[model samples]
Target: MTGKRGRPSVSEALARDERVVDVVIALLTGDGIEALTFDRVAAEAHVAKRTLYGVFGDRTGLVRAAIRRQHAYLGDAGDGSSDLRSASRAILLHLLGDEAVGIHRAIIAAAALHPSLAQEFYDEGPGRAQGFLASHLRAEAAVSPELLFAALLGEPHRRRLLGLAGPPTPEEVDAQVDAVLRTFGLLR
Candidate 1:
């Protein structure tokens, strides 16, 4: 006799989707974009190929979803508190983190071939983070959130992207955040 069949519960579907995204991110980090095939993701995520196809439609969809998940993860790294300095430091640290750096490099290298991925990365990743910071900025602050984010990242982030240096220590992050706030006169 055949057993009853139905779609997975919402929580189950979410968990499976999360697993797929996690596997894609791991593949992207470990072997770059070249290694992120649906077969590999299915195997690593322990989900079926059909499930991936059904959920994401195609490789591009899967990649976009993974990038979006990465952005959400990075953006959520900070505590939920409204402290500007804390939020700024969290964004800086995430930008400089090894995984984020790798993802950034992969997107840049692949952008010529895949403009959609590049746009998604910018919109969902850095753009989202900047919006988060801008929300916390004082109403009367002279500097725009984009400018403030640039100053907060500045040379250190560039060095990380160029592979010339590692992420800053917590102390260095604090110093930079303080300096950025001071420079913008956004200090409390």
Candidate 2:
């Protein structure tokens, strides 16, 4: 018999995991998060359920990993937000838009009854994004950006995503950025 094959490279492993997350996100966007069962994801990604389990541990694990992966796409840690006033509107609307919003709602809903998953979402999302905005303000604009960042963070936007309200228009989003910029003394 042939000797055991060598372990896969890190990039190979991550490529596999990334594809799974991509399929999950696409499915979530198309079918809704509640419909993204392992079976469905397996069929979509052309992988076995056993493979999903092996890579992500379980359903929650899969979701958390998928969310965390997508979360990086929107991560603000290194990217500049100096143009945040203009970009914020696009970013916020997009964040609260169709592709990103469902997973946010699903994770938040999941987190409500599940502490571990909640913590995971917090770490990957609000915890990181809000903090990055705060740091950006401190470094590029002003001091004590905490309040403004918090105000800019969540709520009605998320509400809009879950059929609780409507999406913010460009005018609304711009008004919010103006308000936040004023708070940071970046604008009048």
What is the lDDT, from 0 to 100, of the residue 81 in candidate 2? 45
What TM value does model 2 have? 0.67
Cα displacement (angstroms), candidate 2, residue 153, comes to 3.8
Q: What lDDT tens digits, residue by residue, belong to model 2 across residues 11-91? A: 977787888888887866566556778888888786678878988887667767766664453555547745556445544
Candidate 2, clashing residue pairs? none
Summarize candidate 1's per-residue lDDT along 69-178 as a digit string, tens digits.
54553444434565788788878777778878878888788889888778878887778878888767778889988898889989998899899998789998999999
Estimate candidate 1's alpha-carbon lDDT, on a 0 to 1 scale: 0.80
The number of clashing residue pairs in each candidate reads 0, 0
The lDDT, on a scale of 0 to 1, for candidate 2 is 0.66
